[model samples]
Target: MELESPQRRSTMRDAPWWRPLGPRAPWVAALLMCAVLMSAALFIRSTALESSALVARGMANVIMVAGFEAFRDADGLPDQAALDAFLASHREGGLRYVAVLEEAQPLVSAGAGKVGTRDIQDGSPLRVEGARARLIHRIRRPRPVLGPLTLEETRAMTSVGDVQEPRKPLRMVYEFEPLTALELESRSQRLLGVAVASCVGILALAFAFSRSLAQREALAEELERGRRLAALGTMSAVLAHELRNPLASLKGHAQLLAERVESDTLLAPKAGRVVSEAVRLEQLMNDLLGFVASGELRRVDADPNDVLRAAVETTGSSRVEVRYLPSRTPWPLDAGRLQQALENVLRNAVQASPEGRPVEASVEHQDRSLVFTVKDHGPGIASGEEERIFEPFVTGRLRGVGLGLAITRRIVELHGGSVIARSHAGGGAEFRLIVPARGV
Candidate 1:
């Protein structure tokens, strides 16, 4: 009954900046965490591959230089056996192919079958392609004059009037193994799978936590609303009890005065007005008592159609049309309480409609629940007031106390049912009372 002040309403409307994001904060935090984890995983994988490639390149260069040193014999001539022995010792170190070249001609080579044309291209002397690497080295060839010809001996021979021809350059080509590259890729792919699976698990947990939080908040709001309504009901019951005797006395005195003043034209009209207003106050007191006592229920097996007909009869409006389901089965219900609730809803529908328009009523069974629908050919509920109209002391019209729909909702809830209100497409309002048959 007390209206809210404009200052309090304005303060509520001006909420904090972050209030809009409060409900979605859980999802936002989860997505940000997942993004960070995925980025770290990808960075680590790339770094690991880069480090491995660097190691492979260094090893290939070392093997190429070592092979060139071992290819020469004590007489300063090419030795096939020494080169072959060196390759055999380091084969497990990813040195899959090796070749010695003179003037672009292959002199002696090992593992030549595994080398492809695409593997050897014109590039830097020491280069790496993925997990594989290549290295080229050039070595000097000394002409032999004796069992072992030193650099000084060769120079003396050339200076003593003995001219010598220049020697062709020898080059070594090395190709690292492919198996090492494949193994690295397989390990990285496994790590990627682990990252994806972890993110999925975390997303599931976040969704579950958000859902649980929402349910908890809803229950808390419901408890607070119940507390407030309990206090209001207690005060209402006290006021009704205190006002009843005085109201009855006023109604009786007004009626007696009206009978006595019937011969006087103006006095009779004034006295009648007092009696009518007193009667209206008495009805309000009765409604308050009923609203306060709506929590208790007494269930009995009874026919719902009979209850529907009784409510319609109480409305006593000629413009109302009834459509009842053919089936007549008994359900566990508080006949008196349910009929009272139905009567209130039906009367509201009848009163809201214009004089000539008809109010429609129907009953049906769905999913083991009974549904009672009432539609009035009225202006219908306002855009946002459909829910607020069900609160006690909240009304669209100026006349009468607004306890009818509120009391109806309380009684329906006690019967394990719900009330839904919606504006019909054809310019009216519709209300449905869905009551479960078994659970109550």
Candidate 2:
């Protein structure tokens, strides 16, 4: 496969808001721009001042080199004779130095009085070809007070060789001024300190701004939630008022038919079933509205055993068994409402239990609280539907409007209690209601 270049890939990844940048990017860019401006200024200054300094240093080196060449050559040094002879033949032109230098060695071959005739020479030139410079002074010999001469000016200067060859090599030296060490250190430290202080300030402001943004987002979210709840409340009130009157009429007609029906006859049996179902539906609607009624609490001390008995009585079944470890326990409850809530849970359990599989009701006192349990043996509810079954208007049965469990939960929560529904160990769902007992 062919590969795309980095530039093309980077362009593809670019998004409008997901800029390859940060909140502080603009501030940092501004700072860098200032540094660039200052750098441009410094560059201009350096170009001007350094150019002048280099010219001045070059001129000084030129003067020093020329004067030193004259003085050094004037002295009677080794190979100086050759330099003088070359000078005599070729007078001063643009030639900056006639470098005739030497060693202090005696030249002899018995027949020729002094075999190597030259004993004097000139020095090499020094110059600053492409740099800043300050070359100064000249020397014929190593001065006792200071040192040997260095001609920086003649570093780029022209030179011509003398006529005679030297018996020994010459020493070469380089020269230039050094930068002041302390001045460089001070400037570097100052720049570093300023950068650090600016970065610290930027980070502190970033933290405060981020925190402020988060708080504003949270407040906006809370306001949105309150608005939604208020709107829902208004709609629910309108819906309940509109539906109740017709529902009452339907219930009345169902009851009239039920009074005239005979249980064994076919037409009457069907009519009786219609009445029973209609009554159940009407009762469910009442529960739905009742669960949402304004008052949430009417706490009172009452026997938990009595509450169980009332729930069983409401079920109107003679077959279901009741069992309790601690039959009587004083529980703080809104007696009438709590009895209705438990009745709803028990009635569902009885319906779900298989024929001849008697539903079991039990009550116990634990940890300063009353625990009531209802168990049934039947085909287990679908796990997926279990939680949804308690949601308003959701049902497992075809005929149900699905408010029983939802109303049960509303009442339990109203009384500062809890309920849990799950499959029982013996084979079916177990619903438990836990409420506080009447005590400190």
Candidate 3:
């Protein structure tokens, strides 16, 4: 009703939450994200480089230790030099040691027990048998050492009998990187990887949450709509019952008026028109009542073919011969309702059928359901409207009210069946329907 002044408007528009600030506004960012990252990376990288040689040597020691552990954890004793050489390599990157611990003798018996027999024979090409069944193991606590550890520091970690020392040295090896550039590089890459992974995980979570919220909102809307329809149906049912009897009486009175006068030819035609319209009105009222009780159903076992034949006869189409093989398949049916439904189908077939072309009614069994097909040579329904024609009050006829098929479908659905209309591959239209068998 009232426009704001310029000062008030500008103040309102300048609020932070309402502003669009992102990749789009590159020139003047809401704020700059100063990358402490590069500085942090430099510090870590520098520290790592200063320590590289120490780390490489430390890693080599760890490799030796790890190899010694393999011997201790093995099924039998390994060639000592080969074991030491393995540990000296592959265990780099400032790691002091990585080893597997097991009992003194591994081959004669692998399960939990004390050191047993010397099961392994001494040889360059080792020969062995039985599974090297691994088991739960533990590492020995390293004895303390107090000196600048030498590269031979790896020897202390070997299995008791593995090398030049049958009895391994009793000392813990301690080592650290001397602060170097390579360490800094490795730390920077690790930090960057962690940051990127966290950002991606955050975005994925946001999208999933948003989609879930939207689906919940849509479901809530649909449930509310269904509640409203249920209320509307109750009111319509009440109104239809009240209107039917009065409408019938009105038609009867008009008929009486037509019989009472001879000079009322035009008046008689007017009375007939009144009666005709009244009948149409009654039919429309009945259809509304039908819609209100669309869910109510009574199922029984009955022959679909018999029901279809009866409907054809009721249509009074002497020229439209109904052809169907009498099949013994019994379907779960609501007899009166099924008759009404099929009669509607036949009526549409009869209307669509060209005079000498016989409208067809066939029933067959497929899977656990019964299928009823009614086809005619009449021009096919308009392509786009095939689905719409099933709605209540939609008709193909020039003056059709369209309710015929809608009511028919309601009858079919109550019996756990569905109807569909499609163009026949051979040029006409076919209506194929399936209904579940009764007591199956």
TM-scores, one per candidate = 0.77, 0.45, 0.50
| Tens digit of per-residue lDDT, candidate 1, span 1-440 | 99999997897789766446655667777888889888988987897688667666667667866765666444554456655666677778877667766756667777643334343446367767665667766767666465878999878987876776777787677777645555776677788788889889878887887787677777878898889889989999999999999999999999999999999998999999999999989989988998899476898998999999999998888888999989888989998888888888898899889999999998899899989999998999999988888899887767778999999898888989999998999788999998898574
Q: Sort the predicted structures by TM-score, highest score first.
A: 1, 3, 2
Residue runs of model 2 more than 4 Å from their true location after superposition: 1-240, 257-274, 325-327, 381-387, 437-440
| Poorest stretch of ten by lDDT in candidate 3 | 125-134
**Between 2 and 3, whose TM-score is larger?**
3
Q: Which regions of candidate 1 fall more than 4 Å away from where they truly are?
A: 1-21, 72-84, 101-108, 122-131, 136-171, 178-198, 382-386
RMSD (CA, Å), each prediction: 6.6, 16.9, 16.9
Give per-candidate clash totals. 0, 19, 25
lDDT of 2 by residue, 1-440 (tens): 99999998887688445234444444555566557655655555555555655544554555445435544644343354544454343232222234422342332111111112222232224334333222222234432364554685344333444233533544322223212222333444455566566566666666666556556666877688557645644565566667678767876886777677766476787777777777776676566566456655777778877888888988998767987555465667888888888888888888888777898888887777677888888776667666666766677777766767877877877766778888866788888888765343
Local lDDT at 217 for model 3: 59
lDDT against the true structure, per candidate, is: 0.81, 0.60, 0.60
